[model samples]
Target: MDDRRGSVLVLTNLHDVTTDIVLRVLAARRVPVVRLDPGTDLLAEASLSASYGTGGQRGTLRTPSRDLDLTRVRSVWVRRPSAYDGPPGLDEHDRRFAREQAFWGIGGVLASLPHAHYVNHLWNNRAAEYKPAQLAAAQQVGLLVPDTLITHAAQEAREFVACHGSGVVYKPLWNSPYRVAGRPHSVWVREVREQEITEAVAVCPHLFQARVDKAFDVRVTAVGPWLSGVRIDSPDLDWRRRQGLMRCEPVDVPGAIDQSVRAYLAHFRLVYGAFDFAVTHDGTWYFLECNPNGQWAWQPPDVTDAIAQALADQLEKGSAP
Candidate 1:
């Protein structure tokens, strides 16, 4: 079979600019690409039929704009997709049931496509989202990680903060949607004092780590075997808060860090990852976290273009049997 004959299936919502960038690269290469949002599309604009037996699994997924032969999928990009909410105008219980059926039926078939490579497989992505697992993997792969603590006990949190004389920072384990006054808000990393660790800490598990006294920050975007490191100079504790004011430039990745990064990705079975690190004045990179499907198109033009091209190359090459 010709390796590049089939389509590249992209799973993402409509308003994703990152997906648009990658799509353009795929288009320039003349690769057949099928973009769809299964969450909403399955309710009306899409239909799926899959069957399995001795002859093996087979199916056809029909979207308004394209039809995908399951066996012919060259690759799958599990991008940012919305949750399946099912069709409209149903009772709450019925809607829940419909959504579950759609998820297992449609999602299972998509995941079962043979000989198709996922940039970051859905199962691996889900498993890698845990910060604890990421930190453990980084440490095992020879990356420096800060002294961290996860606890639901007020006394333990207080003790952890006091032990770190320099300082400790509080960060959310997961960035779930939060809103105040009907406007979305994010829980950014901030310095914490012992007094701040009150009874509220006992309500849920909290993540606290010894603060890194860093000179600058690094965002390493890894796509398969390629890596692009961007040095960000900002005057804020969390650079994301003042992205507009930060200065970003390409930086050469050190030999040791590069090796560990590749190993770390392999450990998680991920083909793509955006890793954040805090670099000290003496040149030490502290592993913060890795987002399996983080954004990369926001970087400078050349860097973004390089990443997009690398991704397109992987998708075009497809998977090996």
Candidate 2:
């Protein structure tokens, strides 16, 4: 392994398709790459400054007792890293110990490094997970936002719902695992009734907002300044729910919305964001939410290819010149 040049480190789910897109781009450029699941022993070893890096197409990435030469590391891209699936043979206590340390350790090490241009710093990502923070940021940048209320009291929720009408909707305060019949599930947007608000707040502070009556949904993929994507039309309140009921077509993102999205990314110090927006019957655009490290590979191949290219461009531009 050369000490002068470094590789791109991707923290991602093992089966993630976008991982291949990124890896291929770097390989095409002859840039060394290191792709690893956050849960692996290799991550822990590297985090603790133990010797690492066995050579492969992913290249020579290692951590000796010596500190990593961050100046050599051009950039780091963190995708969706799933929770650790512990190695077999450990008791529950040992498993917990490893998992907990691994979680904080990786972030701690990466944060302390001086020169790595994180696509989106992990700490910033963690803080931006709050829906309120995201909404506030959007509003600060002059983007139109839907009427929203967050409350733990049921009566407060009822009052808000009464004002927003039956078109009111409920959303999770944080990203939660959805499950049904002992299996995984995903949440979809749906209209709520006054009766549906029954005992909802007793569990926790549920997020309620006026469901914008929309002509279509706009997905904004921001890779540096290369923001692009299409508007999607679907009958379902949540386009995600109507996967088979929708149509997508390329549409021009308004300049004001584009500027606001750029400011939002700058506020969070991120290079990429998958943003959701609602375009109403009158053509009014409302800010929905931003997924900092959201998936872009699911879009059409040409879009995915452009995002990959933008990322590579950043890596090369950030390198010593």
Candidate 3:
């Protein structure tokens, strides 16, 4: 009965390959899609107007080339938060302040739409991105979780490693993108040697975990009520560290695992997620983490096709697809 309904909204970076595949599927399916990349679009003549009162907030987003009524949007897929940069010629401090302003200003409005079925909503994605929260939810759903600790004290880290006789691994609190010598750098998950826990640990909080003796990695991509999984086998500690070197095969997820995954998604209020598990030789699936809006375009051919089709279905059919 609503007159303001409109196209599906996708918030993602321009270079996201998964977004590209899904967009193509939506195009072939004749589903209306509005793509917004905050990094490039937010400041370049993108407009938003929201009204606040007793009935709550209602608004419209206007790009230079199109208009989207917030109340009309079928669904929103927040793939990633873009970089907000200040205008040219500002000092470092002033630039940061301006970027902050841009982030809150435009981002706040997008986050306030009155009627929309977001695949992984911004607020929910933010919460589920935390590893601790994910692990807690996994345990509650009867999934085995590795013993974990988040600390900055070297002594505490050493003690944790000693207590966890199976040995321990170190992971970044978050995979924050940065650069070194003007080139991109990243922190990959790797095992920790007791002697390597040095004074540098005091620099910031670090995540340490008991290493799971794994047979392989399982990546399950959940799209609404449907689920598909792939087993990853590689010589590297983190298969993603050497993407092309890893072998991927379709996995038949057990009913129990499927139910627990559904539970995890419900706990985070997400319609889509990429769940990672470490499978032991004994067939135990150890929960590692979940990416609310993970990459899928690079998966094997059949997996990619299924994912794209699933996303296209969701966009075309709205809440039920």
Measured by TM-score, the strongest candidate is 1
Q: TM-scores of the models, in the given order?
A: 0.98, 0.87, 0.93
| Best-matching candidate per lDDT | 1
lDDT (CA) per prediction: 0.92, 0.75, 0.85
Indicate whether candidate 1 or candidate 3 has the larger lDDT.
1
Residue 124 error, candidate 1, Å? 0.6
Residue pairs in collision within model 3: 5-72, 6-72
> Which 10-residue window of candidate 1 scores lowest in summed lDDT?
1-10
Model 1 lDDT per residue over 5-67, tens place: 989999999899899998999999899998888898878778888889998888898988878
Query: Candidate 2 or 3, higher lDDT?
Result: 3
lDDT tens per residue, model 2, 181-258: 999988766677776677757887778899888888999999887899678888878878757788777779999999
Order the candidates by TM-score, highest first: 1, 3, 2
Candidate 1 segments exceeding 4 Å error: none
Each candidate's root-mean-square deviation in Å? 1.0, 4.9, 2.2
Candidate 2, residue 247: how far the Cα is off, in Å: 1.7
